[model samples]
Target: MTSTLVENHFRIGKLPHIWCPGCGHGIIMRSIAVAIDELGYDKNDVCVVSGIGCSSRAPGYMDFNTLHTLHGRALAYATGVKMANPDLKVIVITGDGDCAAIGGNHLIHASRRNIDITTVVFNNNIYGMTGGQYSPTTPTGEKGTTAPFGNIDRNFDLCNLAKGAGATYVARSTAYHANMVKQQVKAALENKGFSFVEAVSICPTYYGRKNKKGDAVSMMEYLKNSTVNVKAADKLPKEKLEGKFLVGEFYKSEEPEYTEEYKKIIDSFQKER
Candidate 1:
């Protein structure tokens, strides 16, 4: 039987998601749901948006105001939703390819605007839903169907990109660190301006098989061993940190949110009238 949390937050009929066995997207999705539940936000006041990709399917299963929009347009639609109804808590669930490839422009602009929306990127490195193509976040030299000779492009550190683009809150966590993902997501949702959380996930069917990354268990174990918390990383020696990625909050600051600023202009015009 599904837990009460799942029953409450997820569509009961949508149980048994379609993700491949060992895919880490489910864990990331669960983390998002848990974060929302913990925050006690009324489901009707929450809007979940998603673009086309493996991870984009999340909003379909979630029991909330949802928009399964066009590929790479999740953020655009989310921005409109927030502007139209500032009272709604908007959260976007996007995949690496969906957000960082065709949707990259939207991602940067949303961060730049410091809009009041939370974005959770389920980054599985490769384009799992689109035939295992190399994505913007696929590491250099990683194998993908399109890059069987090995991907030569440099990968993006999404957190860095969001921070540079002016996101008020930025953080990263792997699906292996379920609790950390939940914590970061909770913090991101609570922030009043643009927020981003990268949930590094595994694609056992595609990325794993193509890259010879073993099974789901091996990929999960790799995540457990290859990441360090930002706080602990600060205390560890450089040598100890080599080859390990830093997880946890990287940047956060209060900012004038775009919606709020826009409202100020509207109120001024109304007073003038």
Candidate 2:
């Protein structure tokens, strides 16, 4: 029953994803599947590592090798996995909270090291797994259960964070732009260093209802209308740019992957010895 979608990539008896209706995580998951299938990597050679969150549930349904790690530990575990077996293609799927809040150090360091791994941040802007608490990526001035009046803390611009932390490939996409998301994820996978894909997802159950976003459909519409391509985005006049957001491949560059670079240093020292 393998469709052209992921003939080699799809797992056995893992159909019917269980995410809530209108949850953007499912869309991101499909895009990932498509991207991996396009990469032509065998399912056995790929592993999906995830931390505790709604997004983390993704690995469970995937047919390929998967690891459901502790809260905020996806990066650490994935780092170990890559270090132990450099032949494996590891992908980390984590929510905004899991990746940006408690696991922030791991996320930053992994990018700095430029390990041969791909990180996909399902940035739904709030903690969807738990009862909607404010998250590091939640928009400022938005009301949450904790921030009844309004959120005062500024949110981390995830794309900027990844780029600043030295990730070799950084991209932003959304459920609205499903095809674009696939393209960016594929690009990241093809790259040979720390690759990142920040797919802004929709959380109607938490973020939408709390912010009076109407419903899942409305929130999705918002995501669609909010984004602009990076190139055209920069060209937008200042006044027109207000209240709008960009979602596209932001930056990409080739750099020495940490593992390969370390091997080079070791080889050099061995020659001297």
Candidate 3:
């Protein structure tokens, strides 16, 4: 079944990707492909844009109109693509560092506009591709090559950031939860306004070794045991939910999408002219 999915959705020539053994990015990438395949979207009408990072390599393997853009600028390019041809389905594949750090301003504005684009953030905590630096989403006190003495910075709750910035749809899942990740990606794609999905992936090669968090399988197990459903989370007290994280759809609303609103203004101006 997995082989069939890869054969159907990936570019055959692009096999043998560079991700490390047991790295979760491959799983997340496959989940995205599964979601797109399940939606039965026309390849010609699908635009996969990505920034410079390990996760950004996803668009290269995908069978779509793909753009491997500058570091931290995937969202900017995707916004232009969606605005230029509103009919196209634009999906931005970004990493935690690429999106939440360097391209953070773009993220905020895009969500505020409620642009009709689906953004998938692969949050592996550390910057896996760039020598294992601590990223904006890296957990506090977690050790990275850049933080050998343990990091003191606070991590970003990306789901909350998207929701607060006015994104109409937002969800989160881990690479270990393959089916849930696929479903979340599908829901993001179907939403008309801006949608954000955070896939908490594992970087066993770097993050695990540096932090002594065991191997890939153990990290995946941690994800499974540490996450609670948002619905169930609400019933728990703040202290009880201290160490655990919330997963599942965090927010959804039927707001007016930016492109549609722009079209209305253009139509009005044309009538006056």
Name the TM-score of candidate 3. Answer: 0.96
Report, for every candidate in turn, its global Cα lDDT versus the true structure: 0.96, 0.89, 0.93
Task: Pick the TM-score winner.
Answer: 1
- For candidate 3, write residues 90-178 as lDDT tens digits: 99999999999999998999999999999999999989998999999988999999999999999999999999999999999999888
Name the better of 2 and 3 by lDDT. Answer: 3
Compose the digit string of candidate 1's lDDT tens values, residues 1-273.
779999999998987899999999999999999999999999999999999999999999999999999999999999999999999999999999999999999999999999999999999999998889999999999999999999999999999999999999999999999999999999999999999999999999999999999999999999999999999998899999998999999999998999999999999999998
lDDT over C-alpha atoms for residue 73 of model 2: 96
lDDT of 2 by residue, 65-121 (tens): 899999999999999999888889999999999999999999999999999999999
Ranking by lDDT: 1, 3, 2
Clashing pairs counted in every model: 0, 1, 0
Query: Where's the lowest-lDDT run of ten residues in candidate 3?
Result: 1-10
lDDT, candidate 1, residue 77? 99
Sort the candidates on TM-score, descending order.
1, 3, 2
